[model samples]
Target: MTSDDSRSRRIGRRSYLRGSLVGLGTLSVTGVAVADESGNQCPAEEPDESEEREETEESNETEDQEEIEEQYETVVDVVEAGADPEGNESITPVLREVVGDDTLLEFPEGRYYMDEQLRVTGFENVGFVGRNATLVPATYHEFDGPQYRLFRLGTSDVPGRDLRFEGFEVDQTADETGIRVISVEVEDGLVVRNVTVRGVHDSGTWGPGLFNVTEPEGEGIVARFRAEDGAIHADETPNAGNMWRGATGIVVNPDHRGTLVFEDCSLGGFPDNGLYASNETGRVGVDGGRFQNSTTASVRLSGTTGRIRDATVVVDDDPHDSNGQHAIRLDGGDHELENVTVDVPQPNGDAIRIMNGVDSAAISSSELTVGDRPNSGIRIDPTAGATTLEDVAIDIDGSANAVRILGEDAEPVVLEDVRITGDATGTRNRHAIFCERSGCQFVGLDVEQVGGDSRRGLELRGSEYVVADSEFVTTHTPIVVNGGDDVTIEDTVGRSAGDGYSLRITSDSGAVGLAGNEFPDGVRDDR
Candidate 1:
């Protein structure tokens, strides 16, 4: 028989059995007996009413039990589990007793109070979700000892897996009140989202949040997390003697090993650093966030490999006890910054500082603005590795150099399609582009230093450099070969509206080759 015919026969048999069993009361059988052993037709016996009633009762009981289990299978509502949701009592004891692995603890719409930290570790598939829930933490003195965090999900040694904590509002607006809403360490798969802290962190304790992915192959994401009202100085808070400048907005420390991404977050002014993820050995990513007015730096990131894309860092206002406020500070690692916007109008440090021990760094499609300060728009350290800046525009309103390359032993730096337009009015007589590193290339540069009389365009002090396809407009000498050897400036245009030379070769400089260049003023060869 064909497969289709066999399938149709099977269907016909099933339909015949179903139709026959509908009339056979209290029995469900696959087949019916046609005759007895004597070859005479036999009739089916009827079921006893007592046995049928008992069976019906047993089936109903089984269904009821299954319904109860299905209702409480994966979710545990905290309010129904002896926890007060009206903020009348502490939920610590109830939480400690009810939380377990492979379950989700959900909070209904209410104000929940926490007087101590709730710690859970070495768990898998644990989650805490809230529906319009507000967490109220006790003040610094009222909280339990080591009163830093509201919830400590896991630790470095016993990290959890597949952890999720989301959808809660933290209320720390009371006087002398603050909290780290959630500090989670996970081995793999973490999602923390939509957690907002509603007040300044004045408790002088830990920050609003701390996240770490403990395994190298793990991954985590923190999205829409905001701590807009930042922290106060530790000395200004009730817990004065315990900590340094108060809490940071968010922190990921050196113990991190896995990749962590902070997405679409917002942080306000803080006493210490903001979004400080430096000193890590993992991959850190900051995508589409705003970090503003934090001491040290607003956004500091360093790791094995890191990226800051579509982010904004603003240092327009300084704190009361402010120190140096760099908009973005990158440390040892391979890092890239793309589509980043930085405004340091009241700058105390460099807008962007690439420190030593970087493997490779690239800043592309970025806009940087610095105020009238001594720091540079972008300062590359002496020991940093190969660096490239492409499609970058820097606006300087101070005496800061638009781009400063420091140290002779630094690797070759490349600046392509960079535009520097600013007035260097500080007394330092800074140039638009100042280079002390050798074997660098500046291509497609557009520099305009039209503010101060002593402002120059390109000051080359290193050797074996090339400046090509560039244009310079300045009051002083547009191109100055001060101490470089075998320096080439070709296919370029230089203009000076003042009485300065278009190109000046200092007496102590080495050989400089100029080709296919237009100089409205003349060149002065002092070599």
Candidate 2:
């Protein structure tokens, strides 16, 4: 009536210290064997499959049976129970074991305090399960490396391969990261589920969270070799470096397998970014999570085949950086964020921004706000990336401009059904869109409101841009095509640009594409 699969593996399996007691640092050994419960050659437990015979007897038709069930009999213990080796509750010798190949080590609930680093290496399919177990690092400025990343996996032992980390609570409360993996040597698969990394480090500003993906081809290796096979002279963009240069959180570097799953996790209150995955890190699927309250941004991502569905990203003033940076400052390649909400609180930083290096990132049905920053709400500097923001709300609590587009490699950026609104003062704080770079287009847009900031409605630079079927109201200079080439502004409506001017086009340069623009008092300010 019962199958062997119904039975569970016990924790306290017999373990022997036959491998020359490697101490606590890093254990390495070969051909080491242990005895069974009877102190003899190790024996494998046979499963009683008698129940399968009964199932076959009852059915007339034969279906494929389940494959052999290889259950991992994990060794578990509590930290307090194994605190003092001399005491009744001391760490079991089984845990300190180097862990044979394909071993599952489970720690019971409690705190473990150790001076040096505790490593698990030279293992495959190794499972480090922390069931209410906390690994506390002793010092701050004194870890194995520069970034006081407390813990590591897969060191000198061919790098821990195919590892799974689950139910572990790392103590990064006062430091930058709770746990840090130095390098995995070869391509390794890592799975981190149900974990929390908290605390704030002021010194770790440029440090990004959930970060470090390898660069497919940067400028590092080019310097080491001479010009040959189109390596150096091809992209001439002098390589930067190699693999997980400077970052925190789940990092994968150097031509390897990098895939992450963030299900029902929270990343906030960090000094810099919340979830940052970049540099040739491919194919990440993120569903359902809250990313907010970081000093810099909520999610700064780049890579290929990324889908962020059903999430909320809030960007506010950083207590550390009063300038209020972008809430979601990014430069990604072929990515999509659907059904997402990006809110920038009043006096908020840029809700969404794109700087350098991006390609084909689509933002659909999202919200972008310009809360309290003095700059634009959404700013795109320069890149050859094809980006789109569809059915979006650009609510500028009061930035001079709501969206600013720059020039870089003559890339094309699109805004469809985009709504821009701001406070009504109109004396200054003008313009809703500023086009800097060449080749940009905006369609199906609405603009309203004003502020006293002497800003323009829309500013254009030395780039080819197209603005069609748009409405604008109260503000200084509604639309102005500044320094750019092949510029087009048409089918647009504006209400007020307080005192300075309604629509001013100075910086007289480049071809202007002006058509169907409904700016009543179009002023060309020479100043």
Top candidate, metric lDDT: 1
Candidate 1 similarity to native, TM-score? 0.85
lDDT of each: 0.80, 0.49
lDDT of 1 by residue, 320-341 (tens): 4676888998988888888899
TM-score, structure 2 vs. true = 0.65
Model 2, residue 495: C-alpha shift (Å):
3.1
Which ten-residue region of model 2 has the weakest summed lDDT? Answer: 219-228
Query: Which clashing pairs does model 1 show?
Result: none
